[model samples]
Target: MTARPTKGGALYALPNALWLTFFFLAPLLIIVAYSFMKKGLYGGVENEFSLRAYALLANAGIVKVAFRTLLVALAATALTILIALPVGYNMARSKNQTLKLFLVIVPFWTNFLIRIYAWIAILGNEGTINGFLRSVGLISDPIHLMYNQGAVILVLVYMYLPYAVLPLFSTMDKFDFILLDAARDLGAGKLESIVKVMLPNVRSGLVTAVLFTFIPIFGAYAVPLLVGGKDGYMLGNVIADQVMKVRDWPFASSISMVVTFVSTIGVLLFLARQKRPGVSKEQAAALAAEAAVAAGGGR
Candidate 1:
């Protein structure tokens, strides 16, 4: 027979349930409703229903901004993964766990805006790097270091590095390094061993990292606003402009709904991938045995 939840359990869950319903579900419902409404003459939404806001998405400018946002988010996610893998691996394998934790935790002590501002100072034309260069006679004029696409991507990668690394480190922490030695003994080179053994084991963590990094970067506003000038503006900037400057709440809501839908689909796909059945221990052992046999034959 199935056991029923206790009164205490119900009581404990009540607050969390209320919080989600009031905060998340309520806001989401409002946004969805607003997306279908008309934009008021001054600001906010109107009582009339219309699809014009969604139709606006077909505009070439809006499409281009959406495309650019996706491109930058993908680029940032890929770069974060590339850098985070080694850092996560080292953290997981390190004997000095204190140092590893310190490295991860220290960055969080600073405010996120402060860190972005720090990047601004470092990347601006009259900023630290350019100032130092000019002082040392490296160039006659300050280099255009800030307000560019590259600077935006660089800052995004830095901001999201911890997100990628933490999930990877969590997964790698449970990994068996002995598998690598076994693969090596079976004549697999370093890269082959990693590809064939390590990656398969930690695929879930990698997916989680990618999702976390990609979703936030996709919706990023301030980073692009400060560092990304006209050339580097993203969908988030467009949404912000619509809401604050143009006061086009309906159009902004429609854009937000599109973002939410796309992000949800991406998340669902990752979850589906994670839920797929993987190879059993016996099959893995068989593969290892075959590799050993092949190695022996080559010898």
Candidate 2:
């Protein structure tokens, strides 16, 4: 039998629907419209429709910057994953829940800009490290650490590591440790058990972590601007310059649209991959049961 629709549920969803329409969808539509328009003689977009802005994206310099941005984002995501895996695992398996929560929450208490500025102080030529070294007569001159690609990547990894860890820890928390025992009983080594049993279970978290880390890093402006000099200038930096300095609104809008489109496509591909056949309902149920047993044992 078909169930009747509930007016109450619709009422509950009204506020959220209105919020999205006003805040997200409306602004997004405006950006899309602007992307198609021509740039004014001085600044801002004109009403005249044109594809010139998008055409500009095909320029060799712009293409190179885009590719460089992608490469740096990929590298940062890889490093974040490598560092986050062990941290998340320890957080998930550790008996001291209070410490784990403290570690996660303390970083959030500090302002993000302050954290970035702190890095600048540590990395700058006349900053803490160089000052200490000079005081100790360790070096005649300061090392060139700030305003480089390596510094940009380092800061990015630091910024996004928590994003990766939280998702991974959430998935790992519900994990069935008994599955590892089962795999070992079936003649699998520790590494083989983790690869064959553990990772597959947390695939969703890993994908979420990758998306969270990659998208933000791709669109990052402040980090690159502050730490990234000529060698580290990304597409985001170019877009920011076009809008703020060059006053080329149309080109900036087009670049923004391209980034949004590419990010959407990447997310869609990841979602599609998740739907493919592998993990079965029975396996899932068994894992749940194992987790329940483990929880009871802990209690």
Candidate 3:
């Protein structure tokens, strides 16, 4: 039977509802409200309602930063997914899934800023990579590895890889490996068998991973700030600069709205694809549902 919320359930849900209201929904509504208000001469938003903040999005410089943010986010997300897919598949099939998952999650035990700085130690110009190369007499000058778009993307991938892996592993764990053998018997190539048979079944995990990695990277700030140097400007930095440096709170709120909107849409997309617990999708139905998405085009 379908369960319905009882009148008494409000008592049980009150604390969580109150928590979301204060911590999440309240701030989100404030940002939405501020996005349409006038920017104050000093810092905060003015009482006067205006669309100037949204209008500022057309500024050529901000547009360029947005474009760069999109590119970097896409590159980082793609790399994370590519690396995570194999690792997830291996873990899903591993004899020691717990150990592999534990190792994947160990990074989270450290403070995020410390982890970023740790990368700096490894990738900085005079850091570990260069020191090792110089010790081996590989070169005279230190190789420039830090403070670029590449570094930002690389670090982003490293940071978000586990998010992709966990979701992919969760979905792939349910996948029927026997489907691959059947595809092989039908004369499918190895890559074809995996891509056509395996990936189609794991669409939920792939979508989850993509959204999880892409959204966070799109709004990345510290990775770009510490490692991106002059070229790694992104929308998150723009929002920070507007609020802290430029003192344009309205503009910052508007950009925050954009990020929030994108995140909401991603969540909706995930909800649309999520399979109900204890229910399974037929392979043909799954392929049909995801054809326009995963397959992209014909062979």
Q: Cα lDDT for residue 296, model 2?
A: 26
Q: Write the per-residue lDDT of candidate 1 for residues 201-220, one digit (tens) a residue.
A: 98877776787778888988
Tell me the tens digit of each residue's lDDT in model 3 across 1-299: 55597888889889999999999999988989999999887778789989999999889998899889989988999999999999999999998999987787766667678888999999988789999999999988998998788889888988887777777887788888999999999999999999999998888778868877787788888889889876888898899988899999889998998887877887777666765553344532443333223312110
TM-score of each: 0.88, 0.86, 0.88
For model 1 the local lDDT of residue 217 reads 88
Instruction: Write down the worst ten-residue block by lDDT for model 1.
Output: 290-299
Ordering by lDDT: 1, 3, 2
Distance from true location, Cα of 244 in model 1, Å: 1.2
Taking the tens digit of each residue's C-alpha lDDT, what string does model 2 give over 135-195? Answer: 9999988989898889999999877777777767777888988998999999999999998
Candidate 3: Cα lDDT at 93: 90
The lDDT values for all models are: 0.82, 0.81, 0.82
Model 2 spans with C-alpha error above 4 angstroms: 1-4, 8-12, 273-299
Off by over 4 Å in 3: 275-299
lDDT-best of 1 and 3: 1
Number of colliding residue pairs in model 1 = 0
Ranking by TM-score: 1, 3, 2
